[model samples]
Target: MSLRRFTDELWSDIEPIYAEILEHPFLRGLTDGSLPRTAFRHFVEQDSLYLRDYARALALCGARAPETESVQAFLSDAAGAIAAEQEMLAGFGEELGEEPLSQEVLPTTRAYTSYLLAAAYGGSYAEAVAAVLPCYWIYARVGEQLLAKSSPDPLYARWIAVYGDESFQEIVRRVVALTDELAEQVSPAERQRMRERFTVASRYEWMFWNAAWIGERWPV
Candidate 1:
């Protein structure tokens, strides 16, 4: 029921996918703020799209989630996350004086969203929990780091506010704990793979943001 245990289990499920994305140098630059503004903004737009899809998946899962369920309850809160993402995105978009993004979702964003949807529709309650944990785990890590220090840029302050805040951490902690319970039944090998995916997903988050903001323009 502990947070570490939950994240550990979730990690087992998604590590390989996470690792591949993390290896990108361009993604690193984006997270660190070395990238250009346009690219970062684009990343934000794309992320908004993904968040919306994730929310949809969560909503669908809720209808099927168990009545006395801990994992389902955790996911139930997740259904509201897209609104949070949109609020953060709006603040940043306004600061840049750009028009708001359209409803269009990017292909990469769609792929990740689809993955979560598939998990929600078909994975066991525990397995479904494992499949979705990465979204929370990496946000907790990044939000911790970004919020601890003053942001070097203004746009990033909102990122700090949304991701690095206390509330988001609490959400991550709860989910990790819930998922860790499921992970206990999962094999160590599966958990290891999930960890790899967790890391890669983290990196992809960076790339996703970068692709939106500064994109391939950064020495990629």
Candidate 2:
């Protein structure tokens, strides 16, 4: 009998979260091109904020990696991919006539980034790898789903297409493979922590979209 891959188990734990993400009105709007402009703008702005910190987390993962190749992949290739994604988000800001750099990071965005940074700084290399996996994996999954039926709004279609790009998916696949390989070296207890971190990140994935959909802001 063959053992199940660690990622498969991680995925099974978050299947419900992924389902909710698919049903989210924000994503639904992306599919039908009916998402409000305000919400999309909010998403782009928050995403720009999110990516800045996410790049930092990726760098930490690189610094913490046991293998030199993993370190190089995270520090150079992964960081470059994030820079490209940030550029894409910047273009969206340009088209929308908004300056994301000037905007406040919403509650969800702050919480998610803080969680990732804490994981990277305070947790083990294995935990850091697990914490970052959901973002890469979930977006690629959503992108694949969105690609099957392109959006009518050119902007939304373009955004969906960015995530759906074969190149981006390849990057995500690399991360997924890395997660599985890392899991092999850890103890079962550590693997459990990895699972927990992956689940939290997955929930945050849903919350991030929901926050934009609802125009989440500081409740001052």
Candidate 3:
């Protein structure tokens, strides 16, 4: 599908980051079932934490949105994020072991969610949308790519299926469409801010997976 000019522009800015993400060791391991269980567990744990805050940011965006449609879209997305996290985590109970996975917020996860919340709270609605877009967009894109090669590991394959499915892609398309709608109305400066927010979030997407591969923890 041909993207709107603004959406195209945003993707152009993140092409490099997205490429790096595709080549990340963590994703490579996921494809081959070679990822250490510990690392995957760490990723899941941090992801659970990330989803909680991510929902909050989405809610903020919903609350700040000018249109009822946009408000509904974001609020629905917020609910979906929470539900998806619960479902994903529940399926991993055995893989994560009977012991409760550590709920500690890894440094990268904290930084990423903090940036998202900050944008949702302080920036314009368009900027907030841009801030959260990468999670939806990158995951859908990565999911599709991974699906083409799908993982040998059932767990990894299941996870990939969730994002790669048509339903999830449709959800992402709705957000991208909203972005294009918002972009068409914004001033050049606001559009530039939106671009910046998208770029920053895209970079975080790479850092997030890389952190998981490295078993990131608070240094202090």
TM-score of 2: 0.95
- Candidates 1 and 2 compared: the better one by lDDT is 2
Cα lDDT of candidate 1 equals: 0.61
Against the reference, the lDDT scores of all candidates come to 0.61, 0.90, 0.91
* Candidate 2: stretches off by over 4 Å: 98-101
Q: List the residue pairs that clash in candidate 3.
A: none
Candidate rank order under lDDT: 3, 2, 1
Which candidate achieves the best TM-score against the true structure?
Answer: 3
CA error at residue 93 for candidate 3, angstroms: 2.8
lDDT of 3 at 79: 97
For residues 69-183, write the lDDT of model 2, one tens digit per residue: 8999888855775776578666777888744444688899999999999999999999999999999899999999999988999999998898899998998998999999989
- Candidate 1: residue 211 Cα off by (Å): 3.4
- For candidate 2, which ten residues in a row score worst on lDDT? 96-105
- Mark the regions of model 1 whose C-alpha exceeds 4 Å error after superposition: 1-6, 9-33, 67-72, 185-207, 213-220
The number of clashing residue pairs in each candidate reads: 29, 0, 0
For model 1, what is the alpha-carbon lDDT of residue 180? Answer: 62
lDDT of 1 at 149: 59
RMSD of 3: 1.5
> Which digits, one per residue and each the tens of the lDDT, describe model 1 over residues 68-111?
56636645666567666767576666775567765567655766
